[model samples]
Target: MHEFTVTPYAVEGDVDYDRLLEQFGADELTDEQIADFPQPVHHLVRRGIFYAGRDVDRFTAAANCGDTVSIVTGIGPSGPMHLGHAYHFYHAKYLQEQTGAYVYIPLSDDEKRFSKELSFDEIHKHARENVRDLVAVGFDPDRTSIVVDTADADVVYPLAAEFATELTPATVEAVYGPPPNVGLGFYPAVQATHLLLPQLVHGPHPTLVPIAVDQDPHVRVCRDLAAKQRYDVEKPAALLSKFLPQLGGSGGKMSSSDDAPSILLTDDRETVREKVLRHAYSGGRSDVEEHREHGGDPSVDVAYQLLFYFFEADDTELERLAADYRSGDLLSGELKRHAADRIADFLEAHQRRRPDGPISEVVEPYRLTDGERDQLSPEVFDDV
Candidate 1:
């Protein structure tokens, strides 16, 4: 057995996802659950990129019944948004479109400051850029709300303080080690607030959080808080996902914080091509003659994984590519080029939709409405 560590802060070793489910106490997403998703299931869910969840049945039941459903998926704006970030966000958009689910996207600028060396200004700058990328995902503004920690502290802080009292420092230490500062000690509460915000504003409803498996601790903590029943809310369900393969082919999660080259959402065609051809790991034989004789392993090829993960959505086409690669009919360079082109195309579409205006204006449509603010924290607008 390969020894591995999975935490919200770090992931090390070759992760055995099934074992991770055991360790985290989350249920594997069964075929029944997947089928329960709105017809024409998303590639991410259908393909098993999102393979595990907690309390998923409840959310699915509400979604299938046309009851109110909500999705809480967030980004920590410590760096640029990458392809890894797009899969879940796009999946969230799909859920919203299919089920009329409300989507809540929170940018944890303060948490980034607590963990990373980046200053608040730098994190906020990234937060603005991240919001632009998220807006490009084309969520229904009426049903989607984007909240930033510092910018919305008027409501975020008050709610966090309420939940913070219930989240003990010892629990924080057990989940995530001792914080360097007091800010992080209280972040779990804020995260709980993020998970519970929909219920707080819209009243109790089934809320789902689609996140990487490592972030399950956040959901677990929030679930514990919800179990206390101090508030009228159900435990937020979680759909946990496997990490998108990094360019380095180290079998680790792709992250902007890592030194590995990430396919940033802003990269152009030429840049993407260069990065893939140079950095993408290959599973081909050392020489062309040997590769043609023994065939390449598409299962281990980073290029093929990219296509399998999200870039290539057609199952037939993906299977064809994989079979051809296994037969040595598709060369590694050719596969890399194909992945690059597909990725560049995705980024181009996203870039085209990316709003170009002042940050406030770009985010205004997605901000929590005055009525919502009053519901979550009426004191913030009491003077108004």
Candidate 2:
């Protein structure tokens, strides 16, 4: 068995995702839960990319009843957004459209500064670009709220301060090793604030946070705080997903911070094609003759996995590809090209929707309203 390490800041070795659920004490998502999702379930959920969850039943139940349900999913603005980040955001958007779920996107620029070597200016620059990509996802501006840690400090910090008192140094140290800086040590509270923002603004309600399995710690930490009953908020629910395979096919999570080549959201069609053909790992035999004789393993093929993950939504098409690859009817190069073409098409549509105006103007519609700000941090707006 390969030893794996899964943490907020690092993922190493080939992860045993099932083992991770046992380690983290989260439940495997049941079929009933998946079926309960608004009709025509998301590929991520229907196909098992989002495989496990914590307190998911409550959120799904609320969504089914047409009750107010919110989803909190975020990014660390350390670099440009990539395909790995897009699926999660897009899934949230789908839920928003299907269920009228309020979406809260929090940009953790401060956390990136504390962890990475990047300057605040550089991180904020990435934040602006990240926001552009997020706005491009076509979320309802009235129902979606985008909060940046530094930019929205008036609301974020006050809530963090209150939650910080409930979080102890020992607990923080245990959950995450000793912090390299005080900023990271205090970040859990800020994270808790982000998780609870919807409830704080609109009163206690079910909130779902869809994140990769590695980010479950943040949800757990926030759940513990919410369990304290000091606040009138419900424990936030979580939907945990497997990492999108990197171009190198190392089985590690694709990340912008890593040295491996990633398909950035801004990459043009030609660049995307080149990256896949040159770097994507193949599960076919070493020689074409041998591959034709023995067939290929679509399960291990990066191209096939990409299509299975998000690009090809039709179940029948995906199954046909798998069968053909296993029966020597599909070549590795052909599969890569197919995946790249689908990806390029998705990116082209996404890029076309991207707003070209100033970041401030683009993000204005999604910012928290004065009433919400005042509700979250009354002290900041007291005299106004």
lDDT at 147, model 2 = 98
lDDT of 2 by residue, 49-76 (tens): 9999988889988999999999999999
Best by lDDT: 2
Poorly placed runs, candidate 2 (over 4 Å)? 380-384
Off by over 4 Å in 1: 380-384
Candidate 1 lDDT by residue in tens digits, 84-198: 8999899999999999999999999999898889999899889999999999999999999999998898889999999999988889898888888998888999999999999
Cα lDDT computed for each candidate against the true fold? 0.91, 0.92
Worst 10 residues of 1 by lDDT: 375-384
Quality of model 1 by C-alpha lDDT: 0.91
Assess candidate 2 and give its lDDT.
0.92
